[model samples]
Target: MPELDAEKLKENALTSIRLGIEDFQRSKLEKDQGGDPARALSAVRNLFAGILLLFKYKIAVSVDATGDASVLIFNPPEVLPQADGKGGIEWKPVGKFKRTTIDVATIKKRFEGFGIDVDWPTIDKLQECRNHLEHLHPANTLGEVADFVAELFPVLREFILTQLNEQPADLLDTAWPVMLAHHEFFRDTIAECQASWAAAGVPEMMQPWLESCQCEECGSSLLRPSQQDIEEGASVDNQDNTFKYVCVACGHSDLIAPLMIKELNDAYYDDPRDGGEADVEECNECKRSTFLISEQHCLWCGAELDYPTCTFCEEPLRQEDQFNGGLCGYHLHAYEKAMRDD
Candidate 1:
């Protein structure tokens, strides 16, 4: 008799997204520390659930009966007769999301009809990853293919904004502390991955090394042998096996012996019940990655620890150690260089 409540569902949708972010941040920490990638799969499952809630919201606010019909299919119409025996039977609605054949296929087609451009190929791949995470033993390869999660955030956020006509900043504010922190982590993680690929310089030769090695500095499994014949930006200092590796996540390049590298790999992948946070300090501001207390700041978010003097951001150095310049490994060095050059 009464109409569906859109406001309440929207509130729930936002909350789900926040919860999903929390799960993802925690699991990501585990993966970065050379722990089991399987731990991160649970985060994927939870995030997908949050995404499904948004789909429900989209369907709930349809422009016409087409929307109701779409929902009606899932919420099957139950045949109910009037009080009088002679009265004809009328259709009663079932629960939400009960319509016939409700799935990725149905949702995609419906979104397309509304001129919403959802990325089907990426979504398709993610679904497969999610299935494996849910049903089979989690693999490092499975984690590798999950790059789509970072790509999907903007798209889904846009869908909610465009359909609901809500302001981005307002949704952002609603998302709050976690939203900003997650955004930073997602952005930095992707950038770190990209930099590693670029730094790989000799990919063809290093493929085997990458396949066998893991980068403890970045907790990345994409470690591979570096191209030894690079230009003499500087002469090799202690060139032994030339078996150095570059981590896509941390950009740490070292000329370690092959046997030493293998030992490091074992140490990195060793399973831990507490995600290896026992020795590392979680960021005080963002609470993302766990770093050594000696660092005095989180390597991921630049959040100060100990004294909390928090000068990391106030003085954004154009260069800090190997990092481009910024705090906690965050940097805008390239942009600053361009400004100076101009």
Candidate 2:
């Protein structure tokens, strides 16, 4: 069997760290836009979770200031060794070999063996972010913190992609199983959030509103499986068919369409097919709140709703007014005058 490519493994580990940062940034954005701050904070914590995974693989190292001086920490996985006969020599397990004062030179040498370049500036930036997260509570604005995370994601992603691409086909194939596991873990987390939102009685219209406003990966729109789902050992295939929303871009199963009150109204009163009750509900983005009426104003905002252009003058209307009907009183006379010339 071919030996594992240490370099590729290192890259994959680092890439996971970067993806965690991206997840954090997305969560931060959702919080800024009036979504759940608790969920966003959880995403930030998951970044450290990713770091712990990387540490297990020896791809990255971490240092913490416990009291005053800095201390390097290792979190390698545990390994069992075969017992030797005479006086049974015990092998040093991976986890027990914690080096408080890690030799930076030695760590660099190991990383170099895996063909990873450890530049001071890059390391410094990563350290800065980690320090801010660890020590400072309100070090920067949410936007600023998010921007810092955004800056790190692509760099880490590219490095991992390159490492994967450089590896032999077999090595690359070996990584697929681990990658799939990670994706499933993230997907499950999303499902848990969805269950929470559903229980909270969040409106269905508001679900799409959240989707449009937040990142798809770390967005509140992504549903999380409930505690019941976990306890029942619910498999993905057994999820409620009506609850699934397939992604248009990546074809991922993440979102669940909520049952809206408006939809029920349309079903009984409007559409007779499924028996023709209202076949479709109102548009989520426009907040129509009812069936579309021809040449009528917005039901909620009372703005004149028009299609394409003004009905009289055939000129494009301002976006704010277009949904309402034509324009306001100011543009009405102008449109009428233009029609007279025609």
Candidate 3:
């Protein structure tokens, strides 16, 4: 077995960490003016590499009985201990060549064994985004890049400070301030946007989509309902029904109804042609596929629908089952049977 120096591995880990932070800082600084996509991509890739390297460093430093350092290497060769002639033992590798280093999965399992409280979901998210950006060009947006950093900051900060016994601010240096500033800005913006949505007085059914709403044109989620839109939404009987929201990021105006219809329908329904029950259906009055059966209202035309009954048998109908010639599914089936018999 080749003698591996623990100090060299540690140095490599530290270098990767510093370079990762520097890349991340560059990405954050250029975020406002539609920053370079390459910076964000590099930031994620370097940070992921740094994290894996740190994990490997931790594993490499752990002491073993034979001092063979086989545990640090993936698919490590079995070693046989023999007498070294002078009341000593020597361990030899089973294979002729050195094995590859442990991978991310192994690192995670080993961390769990060592009782490390790392937030692995955050790590996985970073890895996923990194792969997406590096392999698939322009896969993630700047907002997504900021989101990845914001979610990962606390995990990285905790691990570096508690596990590595190092001051993050000192290690990260210039990147530390940039990370903190970006996190605060990202958090406050989300809070403000959510607050504005809450005050918009959208219906209870539409609240979930409001939080995740994005501008279709620019894909920016920084949309806010106008004051007039809020007032109309609050009013119980506002016939005007013209609610508007503007994407602050893109300066684009869109009607809230169409956006809500698209989002809500996508969230709740699928094509009936695909053999799935459609949660939303076409509105009889508006001829638009914006009818929410649960709400019993056309989201686009404001047409309130009553629970449908079969015209022939007067039986209650399932909300999702479309009425065929004013007949429930049971009656429709019976009519079909009778026609076939005749």
Instruction: Output the number of the TM-score-best candidate.
Output: 3
Give the clash total for candidate 2.
Answer: 26
State which candidate has the highest lDDT: 3
* Residues 175-226 of candidate 2: C-alpha lDDT, one tens digit per residue: 3343344445545655555555454333433444333322233222233434
Which clashing pairs does model 1 show? 73-99, 73-100, 74-98, 74-99, 75-98, 75-99, 210-223, 210-224
Clashes of each: 8, 26, 0
lDDT of 3 at 265: 76
Q: Per-residue lDDT of 267-286 in model 1, one digit per residue for the tens?
A: 34434775553334334454
Candidate 1 segments exceeding 4 Å error: 1-5, 28-39, 64-101, 135-149, 172-180, 185-200, 203-342
Worst 10-residue lDDT window, candidate 3:
232-241
- Between prediction 1 and prediction 2, the one with superior TM-score is 1
Q: How accurate locally, in lDDT, is each candidate?
A: 0.51, 0.42, 0.67
lDDT of 3 at 327: 79
